[model samples]
Target: MDKGMFWAVLAALLVFSLIVATVGGVRDAIVGYVMQTSLQHAQRDMAAAAVRQRAEAARQRAQEAARQREALQARTLAPDQQCVSGTVVTVRSNDASQLIRGGAPVRCSGRLAEVPLR
Candidate 1:
């Protein structure tokens, strides 16, 4: 080959290699950016799910507490029913009852046998 032709071929080859390397670098950068964005979106979704779970738990707890309160209210007793000592108030039939402690209305079904019936 002629010396001039060899030099021209060499120059063209160098330029082509550089272009290929630059394109490869750019592709890598774009892929990395996409991966980072996807990671962030996944993290956000996970956080949202955690928050929703906590909310559901709280709601369940509140519902349970309300059910317990209703059960307690249903257990209130009525007056004139005979009761025995340590006859807890849940077995009674009235709403008003003798104070068991510190003026606290006994809202149970049964009462102490010896205690005066309220």
Candidate 2:
């Protein structure tokens, strides 16, 4: 081939190679950007899910505490029927004998037995 034609062919091949490389690089950059965005979205979703789970757990704990408090209140004896213990056994005014024994009010007769310490 003539010198002029050879030089022209070489320049054209170089330009084509450069264009191919640049296109490939741009495509790779686009793929990487998409992957990064997807990862970020996934992380955000996971964080939101964690927060929701914590909220649910806190709500459940609050409900359980309320139930326990209500149960404790229900177990408490009335003021008239309840009596303080000297030490050994604690008794509530359930009957006339128990009221006299516990030194509780006569209105508390036929009450249920309850022990605060135990």
Candidate 3:
């Protein structure tokens, strides 16, 4: 082959190699960026899930505590008498200058009754 032709072919091959290398590098960079973004999104989603779980757990605990409080109040206020009687009257008036009040005092008089154990 002629020397000039050989030189031309070598230069063409060099340029082609450079182009291929550059395109491959750009492709690798794009893939890496996409993978990184996906990973970040996954991490964010996981953190949000954890936060939701913790909030749900806290809500459940508060509900349980409230239920326990109500139960205790009920047990304390339960009537333990053979005969129990009480009167409660609530009065609400929207009149500007009128007073309203009338109710009998709560009273319990009876022999102690047996309470069953839980």
* Most accurate candidate by lDDT: 1
Maximum-TM-score candidate: 1
* Candidate 2 structure lDDT: 0.64
After superposition on all C-alphas, the RMSD of every candidate to the true structure, in Å, is 8.3, 7.1, 11.3
Candidate scoring better on TM-score of 1 and 3: 1
* Candidate with more favorable, higher TM-score: 2 or 3: 2
Tell me the deviation in Å of residue 10 in model 3: 0.9
Q: In candidate 2, how many clashes are counted?
A: 3
Per-model TM-score versus the true fold = 0.67, 0.65, 0.64
* 1-118 per-residue lDDT for model 2 (tens digits): 9999999999999999999999999999999999999999999999999999999999999999998776656445445444334222234455322333246532321233333321
> Whole-model Cα lDDT per candidate?
0.67, 0.64, 0.60
For model 3, state the Cα shift of residue 18 in Å. 0.5
Q: Sort by lDDT, best first: what order?
A: 1, 2, 3
RMSD of 1: 8.3
Q: For model 2, state the Cα shift of residue 53 in Å.
A: 1.0
**What TM value does model 3 have?**
0.64
Off by over 4 Å in 2: 83-118
How do all the candidates rank in terms of TM-score, highest first?
A: 1, 2, 3
